[model samples]
Target: MGNKEQTFQKIIEIAYVMFAENGFEKTSLAMIATEVGISKPAIYYYFQSKDQLIAYIFDELYKEIQQDIAVDYKELTSANFKEKLLELGYKSIEAQGKDPYFNKIFNQYVLLAARDESYKSQLVELETSFLTSFVEVLQWGVRLGVLDDTPHIEAKAQMLALVYDNIGNFMLTGNQLNYRAIWKEAVHSVIQGGKDDK
Candidate 1:
């Protein structure tokens, strides 16, 4: 990579660690520069502002997840519908758990967006892309008859959003509930009367 590319990547690496550890608000460019063994001005050469850095991280995370799902989609042709659905559930959990610090950054992002209309719109777009993948999986399940057809795919999307909210809550509160068991019960509740009895 060129020096510019290398420096840009280094900045992202430093920002990821700091944002993960200190969160977006608590993290500062000076701290990231200190960690990167570079001056603050050097950091500026790569990113104009901390918000940009945070946005970059969001983009990176989204791209990585979409790539992962694309790979999984290609391999699911032979898998049974139940197996694919379970795989998707597991993948969703794993995606949230990607970076140990991702949860903190994610929650902070949500809070920031809530207070700022512009940030809220950008955040909605980012989150929509992330959630859309799971929505697609759920739609696929319905198509395969593992999950019953809802009139619209969006109801399932809303259900998955609740699931995502649960993950964010687990990250924020460190609540000790048995999430696995809770999820199983919740999923059953959502689909109980809807499944085709064969």
Candidate 2:
């Protein structure tokens, strides 16, 4: 867009790389400024502090996931439940690998917002909106007969948490596992539990 928007995006991109490489405690504003090729004061003009920048990064990412899901919902409304669930699972995992910085901010800052009373309300609203969108997909699946009707249509949220936690653990330790297989099993189990055995 404009120069201001471009600069803001540049800051985010630099922050993402720094956050991924150095983590929350190790990353510094000076490091970001250096990588961004901007003066320290210039950085401050856009983001007063590292904490503010980190929070903004997380907010953008959180909104992005919601936006992407909304787009997918519109295009995939006719797809069966299994297909929709698989798509969601794949996208979530794929995003973790592709946007590790976003993953880092999400696991660190976004989750921490829940612990702070000032941020807790907004965090809850964001979570509620995301869950609502996911549950709508589940309802669509049930209507399509691809998903067995089940109580607590909120399983998508739980599934996402499991996936994210597993990814975070892997990132922190370099441990690896068959995430796709594990996710498939979880989805199958949930779907099976909700369906008639007959």
Candidate 3:
């Protein structure tokens, strides 16, 4: 990468660490600049404000997650649909676990969203995209005859998303529950529409 691109990425990486460690309110542009060994004005050259930098951070993080758990719906077969979904759930959990600060940073952003309209809008857009992807997966299942064509598909996807969100919340709170087991149960429940007797 060019020097400019490298410097830009360095600023972002430093800001991410500072935000995760010191929090959004506590971490300032000067601090990030100091950590990046750049002038404070240099940060402004890339990001108009700390809010813009954080929003960029969140946008990049979401894109990384989407790429990590992406499923090729067209490649799925009825026989492998459940397995693929289970793998997706596993990957989501694994990704969160891979970054010890991710859940903390995510929760911080959620709190930031409550007081900032721009953050709230960005979060809403990210969540909507996530839910839309889940719905698309469910639609693919229906098309493949793996899932029943039901009117509540969107609601079911929301429930599954909630499960994943709660799992992150639980982990962030130092909960010792078996998250994988919970995830498996949630996946099966959503797949069966809560009618799974097995």
Winning candidate number (lDDT): 3
Model 1: lowest-lDDT 10 consecutive positions: 189-198
Ranking by lDDT: 3, 2, 1
lDDT of each: 0.68, 0.68, 0.83
Q: Candidate 2 lDDT, tens digit per residue, 123-164?
A: 677767766766676676677675667676667545654564
TM-score of candidate 3 against the unseen true structure? 0.83
Models 1 onward score TM values of: 0.72, 0.73, 0.83
Q: lDDT at 22 for candidate 1?
A: 72
lDDT of 3 by residue, 80-191 (tens): 7877787877777777777778888888888988998988998898888787878888888889887788898888888887887788887777778888888889789767
The predicted structure with the larger lDDT, 1 or 2, is 2
